[model samples]
Target: MSMEKISIIVSKGSLEGIYPALIMANGARAEGIEANLFFTFFGLDAVSTKRSGHVKIGAVGNPGLHLATFIGALPGVSGLMTRYMARKMDRLDIPPIPEFIEMISDTGAGLYACKAACDLFGLTKDDLVPQVKDIITVGEFYEIAEGGQIVYT
Candidate 1:
């Protein structure tokens, strides 16, 4: 069946965590579906003007640390892994996080921030990425997401 819209909930702040949502949202728009991104909890990082493009992968608690947990505990393994990921992304022509957000916005996707998360994180609208069209509660998001598929990542 064809969908008219899709709502993607992004709840993770880490680089690895955010990508899945971004990919899905972009994919939805690619197929002419309206897309909305709801940033809740730590997911605000991906839409924070100060944090968006600079999200880091957490090596410590990450289940897929890519190295033996013991080896991943080394002082600089996270940085190494981050660099390795950057290289891989670059080779694949993935834009930086900030640019990715811009592209999604330009493609007519709506970006929404979670009000509770903003309050919990002590952030104001100005602290959010420019692409954010509104700060909304989950209830409001639900209203907007009506008749759309909701994918939580």
Candidate 2:
């Protein structure tokens, strides 16, 4: 049976937060399912050419670290976590962010930037990566994902 269309919204800029949305969109495309990814607020970083590759994992206040929240904020700790996450991705064979995004574009998955978000952030199409097909309104988003799953990340 054909999989249903899937719509994913990514509102966070953190690597750990964004990866699930990215991976799911890629997974849906690989399975021949229609997928749409919408970026809003800070999530725009994922589709912004200048920021896409630099989105980092947040180590602060992480429950798994078992450290006081303040320790996570130590100057080098965030970077350390980012590097460690990168290594883990490397071990798991997850491609770097840019390549993964391009793969989604090439595979026919729809990528969109929220219209109000773009305006709110004072951004334009030129600020976004080439993968974004359109800057769509909330109504347009709902229209695209009609009858499909709506996942907010």
Best-performing candidate as measured by lDDT: 2
Q: Per-prediction TM-score, please?
A: 0.94, 0.95
Local distance difference test, per candidate?
Answer: 0.89, 0.91
Best TM-score goes to which candidate?
2
Worst 10 residues of 2 by lDDT: 58-67
lDDT of 1 at 75: 92
Residue clash pairs of candidate 2: none
lDDT of 2 by residue, 102-134 (tens): 998999999999999999988899999898999
Clashing pairs in model 1, backbone N/Cα/C closer than 3 A:
none
Give the clash count for model 2: 0
Q: Which digits, one per residue and each the tens of the lDDT, describe model 1 over residues 39-153?
A: 9999999999988877877777578765567777779877788888889999998877899999999999999999999999999899998999999998999999999999999
In order, what is each prediction's RMSD in angstroms? 1.3, 1.3
